[model samples]
Target chain A: MAVLERSYKRYAGALSPEWSRFLIIPRHAFRDVFRSKLFTGLYALSFMAPLVFAILIYLRHNTEALAIMKLSVVNVLPIDATFFLTFVEIQGWVGFFLALLVGPQQVARDLTNNGLPLYLCRPFSRSEYVVGKMSIVILLLSSITWVPGLILFGLQSYLEGWSWFSQNIPIASAIFLGSLVWILLLALLTQTISAWVKWRLAASAGLIGLFFIPSVFAAILNQMLATRWGNLLSLGSLIRSVWAGLFGTFVQQAGQVQRMRGGVIVETAMVEPPLWASWLILFLICALCLWLLSRKVKAYEVVK
Target chain B: MTLDAPATSSHLNDSPGVITLDNLSVTFGGRPILKSLNGDLRGRAIGLLGPNGAGKTTLIHTLLGFHQPSAGTARILGSDIRGEANQIKSLIGYMPERDSFISKMSCIHFVRFMAELSGLPPGAALERAHEALFFVGLGEARYRNVDTFSLGMKQLAKLAQAIVHGPRLIFLDEPTNGLDPPARSRMIKMIREIRDSGQANIVLSSHLLRDVEECCEEIVILKDGRLVVYCNLEEERKANKKFLMLETRGDLKSFVEGIGSLGCECAMTSDHRLKIILQDGTEIRDLYKLAAASQVQIRRLTYKRDSLEDIFLKAMENGSN
Candidate 1:
């Protein structure tokens, strides 16, 4: 009897648990995203607003530094609900652009080259794949938006003492909750667009347009219909209304700021839609996004 | 010669099945792609062979839980595909019939990512990724971006990814789709080694009968979403009756009748050629004696074992029936 040669070696080790598999996607995605200089540069730039806010908090506590800069005590911005709301608004846009920059590179490349089968053939479910992609944007967006916003909130809490912190505890919650809603929305919308569009640049542009074009359409609908009902079409307004509701004290201040800027009547001039309506719209948009993702994210396209 | 035995020595009846389809049917749009497939495959290396529209790819996808069966169920590695899909997927590797890879990453990174997704720790995944790349003869090009690989290299990289996780079963769809003859031989040799090693049960789907015959132990033939033939290739070869091709000079009809009278099936294939299917007791020595006594010269004589092509043709005939 002759023996056969064996060239393949058997694996004797144990496998990792199934739950740990979902992290694999985001781990590789993070590496891919950070490999780009443009993404790294923009990611670093996104922190500029938060750093300014942090310094503003530092300066607000230092009356001596204000005097050195020849700025009056009255000129110093107070660390209040409106202040954090404005901070969130700025960081929200930063998160938006960051998501636009980062999100397309995540899913669009996977779909274009038919990499989903390689992924789906593994232990990953469709929802897990979506969550894995979503987690990358959420991590990136959170770093720029809520993570720093809460740090600034904590810094202000430390500087202003317990009395101010207790009286303004809602602002801290608002900062966290508001940034989460914003980033989650951005992440979902961007992933949705990236899932549908195969080209990375087109997906990125689609994300930007998902935000900007709606506002333009809302303005057009508002002008033609002569009703604030079209304000519902503006994602910015809907999200801001949710933010205003979260902050509680910023509704009046938001209206005043809009009056000061006096740009589009549909954007700031319109009062936040009924609070429930804003929440409902956000929920609907998120549901629509999830629906789009479930449709497009698949290993094989069913011809029927 | 020992290849006549079942490929795997394990007690297949006692061991868990590699795949079990219970009336598994899949329909796309309105037409059914896989119509009520039912079988239990226990072979260490199973070949899925079929013509166009034979539902080979659909069956692979349904086994991977990429497609939901219209009516029945499929259990892989003894796990139900409907509910235990992820678990089933964790146990098997799939090399789809297309170019599926993230083009931006190096070959190692891509394979490592696949291993990690298949439930290996990152460190172990990286180590195994390198080992797999080397195993598939892609060690030098492991650092090269996947898009830069040649067609053959890409196929090898796909194989590397499929085996990186040490899966219990691996479904390789058209593993040697586009390759030169040498590359195809290399791939077939690697596949034979994998099958011989018994590291993983392989389900190879291909239109090329030679590729299947080279590596697979058991064969399944399908036509029009239905099972045509499923049997061990060794048994099929053994059960086939012995046949001979002969070139005889002078009096071919009388020679054929002389063999026919001895309970053999004989026919003239051409003016000078005779096709003879010998019965159990008949032997080539008897034919030599008969030709000598009949004054017919046996110019050329060759014994022929049934090939996979013969089996495939028989299956196609059966499928038509």
Candidate 2:
């Protein structure tokens, strides 16, 4: 009873007017995803990928001996941190996929399933629906990417050593915040696409195409036109790689920050944009997408 | 997008009705689905009749607060639907046209879940769901999976959810959509029972004219998003042409000449038969004396009264043509 009451207070105190509506959607959205055969496959793969990676590490330890295994990763040419960036990669793919799945369908469900009229007839306003949509996307992103990634990260970090995490945790905090920004951006991007499209598969393809179109244009320029401008404009890969590059170097050495630019393959860091700008664009796009999404959902007719 | 003025705000008013649409319109992708429509219905059973795409469900949505009008306002009870939707929903029982429950869930569980969604406690939701299933005549099949239910039973389960909250107003949209004739009749009878028992006000929408004519005390008909007809069973009949029909034995030519001169219509039913229909203001004494003088026996005299169905059909046809 105390456990129940204790959790209730904690949950209730975290409430905002918007949060109240969102409370069930996160849990519900997760349930929805698990119910889908395709999503369940993706979910299983997510859990399986890390397990495979963990097994590889375990096998490497057994074959090389635990002491030598630690030496190879922790000491030899290991960037001095033994920083495994697998979780970041997983978060990126999972977050993008989940956002793409839920975004358009949530919008399209109102339009296609003819639930918009019925959903509207409930105690929610049009704007409230918009809020609910965004909140659900955010929750789903966290569920599909951040939370799972963090859990795995925690497990690996604990297995690695308490000292490694205790020393590197601040950088870990920064990485977590950065992951949040990436998730928010992905969510808003999908929502913006869903605003115009009613079907999930089409909206998802459109979203993917939007990201790759930039890449295709970049590839044409980089390979065909011989310009690096193509590389800069590949926003999808840039979004994934840049955030991964930033977060993967968690708990950076203070001296390294002064001596070397982090995670750059091209040696000179002249091409990379500032992280603050990335954050601003993400938030700005979120606000803009929400405004447009509200209009789309509001314009949907529930004439049955 | 929210109106601050209480008088103008259609969402917050507390009027006594299960459902009400004052003035509501819904547009989809720049196409107007519903226009300025108003209906004031106080009967236990009120039918909303219209052709396909005539905004029956749209009006239901507006009454439910799923769609707010662009121009006019709507109110459920005294609260404006735009302002106090939660309050209105708490009292409204809505059975939407589409399938709503998760397919994997059993009928009993789905009803309980929806009841809980409406703010009922778990135990209370269960109790109410059970009672509602029983009331909707789904007692034995309540425990079966919703996927196993026939279309009629699934529809009944949806109906069960709507009433579980004990809302004052209930909206049943195409409740008998896929039902066979007998099932359809049973559904209609259930609606009548729900209303006649005075448990709640029902606004049932269907294209079935017979259902409306039999079950409803009043009907609001919509055509192309516009209200084409609103008939109070008693008032509509009263306003229609009421006249005495007389069966007379005479040559149609003589009866026609005499009745035409008297400003009456002599309808010739057969070779030797004529029906002299008396207009409201016609002097009955004159007709009797004329009949006596002509040696026409008044074989039959009866007042011709129109049924509600006739009024509904005429209104729709007039609106269309």
Candidate 3:
């Protein structure tokens, strides 16, 4: 009987990060980003918004021609650059909301059930986990910002004719690259703030403050100080100024060929204080946020 | 079903006979949870049972290399906690008490993912996942999305992920917890199968003694970060029931006077009927011949086995206060 008792017994669980731990975040984020109704809706809006603006521009341009010629229907319309700029501006604005949604949930979900402890029991350390999360945020931002932006850029170029594509490719790419930097900074800042705080809502709100509040304060300081650098210090002003700088450069050089009817486009030329400075500021912000994030990382066993 | 070849590994028998503590302790949030707990642990299945606020999770965390102990050492599986966490952890399969699986993935995918993380090759990982899920008896349901799974299914999925890697040891924090009776039994059977295998060892901790009693060969009890009861179910089961039941072919009454001298007490009901409460060192033949030398009718006799509950309570009584 004693031997039988001993024979029937068993013991078993050891969790290590060396195995399936990384799969948890990536797989969940993939499913959440690709399969959820929320992401689908957001993704559709992101892609379709550009087309909608293009269509509206086409209708506006050709409507008068169709009316004057008394044609029953119009098959073609010119692409308007104004609609494209508006799309770019709206893209930056919408990114803020996207950052708000993505940042908080990542940390808050872990905190809710003491999930950190269970996961810590695995082979991964807190740093690796944080890195994994940051990787997901970067991927999410890339999908939203660059992917759709590139498609829209291509679509617009095709509609504008091969002449415009050949002439404006360099200028268009530089401006797009600048926009990507902006998106990268926005995503990193928001995600870092999210990791630093426990509550999802509070983290989201905190990210908003981290992203915009300092810029808002800087704007007010610019008014009082009346210095270009003061305005440059504000993140919003920096983004606006940098993008405007890139656009202004495009206008001065590329517009020479496009031949703008309005007074010589001077705003693009005004974005002066060197392109490297804007990049440096963005780099600084990203580094700061990551440092703060490293501080807030709590090591414990996280489940799930 | 025994190895004629003696086990060669020093890990299996040379040590782990007694758990030795060298001023091991842990603190959390400016408060000490385990205050320099020092002791030796030797037994089969150990249950680190404690109340909710007693820092059971914290201690397990330290053991799993999650938390650095504020002071001292937690030696398990042949090395101090931190020094051999990798070696020790490679041998362990952990089942957490809650539903922590990736919610949207299919069960098979989730288990397979963990298996790969445990260093299994892709083909072997998927195969093991299927076998593990089948072992846990979740077969066809393995392909179902975990988000849609019921809580119990999710729990089982977590368990499946833990065992898919074929770890050498396992730390189950309430495996049967929150499970229905049937689900609990199914889980118990799976644990038993894993335990009986010679490939691994297990140190499962749970507050539920019933579950501990179900499959554990030994139980090491803990309370308030201190050792409370180390109930060896195998030893305890042998200690109770039919105390000193004797059979003889001669006069057992003639042996009545010699029973106490043999270091055991006796109960004489009739001339030939004898019941002896054998002491710690009493020979089986001493009683047999005592009756055989004279004349006593040989009858049926055996010592009854003790239930785990009874032994557990006694151990608990002895350990506490």
Candidate 4:
């Protein structure tokens, strides 16, 4: 229709399926997200770690490069569980920073601007709206985390042959599963804060405080009470414990601590919280975030 | 541009009533907001009117499925709001009263986003978004961010998004709120045009009785959470046709006697002014003929039909009783 005619016309076109309608949120959200130069820069920078990991995997297989560097294949960082574990840890932190940059404004913008009714008044539900906003962080973090982590694993599997791939399948599982857990946690936590805080800067600070402040309190508690149970209060410690377990390094990392007492060296095994406790704490935190999210994300507020 | 034939959705039932409230009630924290509102609103443009705190907005919210009805249910386009809210929502468009827009989105993009959420395919949504913007007279500023638009522009943008997807029913909550006179007239004109187009049913909730009186064929007036009045505006106006006011010269006694002989009730408010309540089967022509025959010149004549304000005020009085 020409702009001059200025007549309202009926749209008789076909509609998208109900199930896939939620994808529209992320589709539009991605456009707004990439419009930010800072976010775009950070998102582009996120791939550097994956690119560097791929180079490390390539160098481990290139005997010419290893010899030129005066290093043997054995002396180079082995493409093993620890190697992938370190890769996941670095990518996980990168994903956190990426989410921190983007996630705080996802739900907060809608609530602050009175946009929820526009969404809810459509065929969309509250859960779909939440999932749609959550998908922004989920998709972005997945690309930087497990998606590339698995690609790196596939590269090693292709280069090192079937025997190496068959023997070290757990490392691949750990990279995928561990990154998934962290991504879900970050997505839910950041959205929860966004919904509650409703201010972008304050929400960013809340996300940082949610993770770091608890760890500080946990450290103080552990020192004062002499208990490993304080790890339950620290989300970072709980997630680290879970990641360590997933990578098969929990036992090794918790094996021994050597300290000097009375001018003598005494080696003692450090006590650690049960891996199940960490898993339980993370699950409870995620559940709490979801409950809090459900409470705040509404189209109308009821006043009495 | 040529207009397509009005599209009808397969999901919509061919019911006469656009919205049917079946004893619907809503309470917020034990305080009733809507108390058993029951009516079948079937007009092309239904006006919802009430004083402040009379539950006008709450009724719209309940029908939109924003607030679940505490007692009974309402049907929008033949779908039950309780069981088929999603289906009802798919067939309806809503223009909220408050300022609602994505903070940084352009007018076209915001309307397109709303269209997509309403179930239009992405390409169709973008196309219709442009058409809707143009229709609302925002074509020149479609590229501007909605937040940067003036209040009038924002109201038009909200309207553009509401009608973009060709919904079967639309809920317009205070659509003319905060608009200046020209903008308000433009909004009212567009609303009447939409009503005349026969493409969608409108539920216009507003505090301004003039806005409602101008655009609506049927009205539902609420008072203190109760359905005080529900009637067709044309029928209400027609019912008040018996009352008339007249200014006259010459022999008024003969004219009064002639009016009384026609079974009309006439009261002499002053020497030259008369208030006549015409009886059934009496027409204004009969009075004019009687005045001519009685040698009384009918100087001025006015039919005193009840305005919407009168109807609203009367309803409020009766609701209080």
Query: Which is the leading candidate under DockQ?
Result: 4
Best by lDDT: 4
Ranking by TM-score: 4, 1, 3, 2
- Write one digit per residue (lDDT tens) for candidate 4, span A1-304: 4556666556677889999988999999999989999999999999998999999999999999988889887877888888888889999998899999999999999998899999999999999999999999999999999999999999999999999999989988999899999999999999999999988999999999988999999989866665567888998888888888999988623566566779998876656789998898889989999999999999988876
- Span of 10 residues, lowest total lDDT, candidate 4 chain A: A251-260
How do the residues B1-321 of candidate 1 rate in per-residue lDDT, one tens digit apiece? 111223232423555578877777899988988877767787889999999879999999989888888888877877888999878887888888898898789999999988888877778889888888888889889999999999899999999999988888989999999989999999999888888888889999999999999899888888889877787886666545467889989877677778989999887878889888889888789999999888899999876676888889998998788
Candidate 1, DockQ to 2 decimals? 0.40
Per-residue CA lDDT of model 3 for B1-321, tens digit only, reads 011222223224465632345566787666777666655455445556655655666666677777778887766666667687666665567777666665445888878766665656566767778877777767779888877887778778878877777766677788887889899888888777777665555666777767887777776555566555555676666665427555555555457777767778888666555676777767667666755655555576777566656655665576565
| Alpha-carbon runs more than 4 Å astray in model 4 | A2-4, A252-268, B1-16, B251-290
Ranking by lDDT: 4, 1, 2, 3
Scoring only the second chain, what is candidate 3's TM-score? 0.77
User: Model 3, which residues run further than 4 Å from truth?
Assistant: A1-24, A37-104, A143-184, A192-221, A224-234, A238-304, B1-21, B38-44, B51-55, B83-88, B116-124, B228-231, B235-252, B257-321
Angstrom error of the Cα, residue A97, model 2: value is 5.2
- Report the number of clashing residue pairs per model: 0, 23, 41, 0
The lDDT per prediction is 0.83, 0.64, 0.63, 0.88
Tens-digit per-residue lDDT, B73-192, candidate 2: 776666677777778876677888887665455788777756655555556667777777877778789889887888889888888877776667788888888989988887788788
Off by over 4 Å in 1: A1-6, A223-226, A250-271, B1-12, B240-302
Question: How much does candidate 2 score in TM-score?
Answer: 0.67
User: Taking the candidates in order, what DockQ does each have?
Assistant: 0.40, 0.09, 0.13, 0.66
Of 1 and 4, the candidate ahead on TM-score is: 4
Q: Which whole-number lDDT from 0 to 100 does residue B198 have in model 4?
A: 89
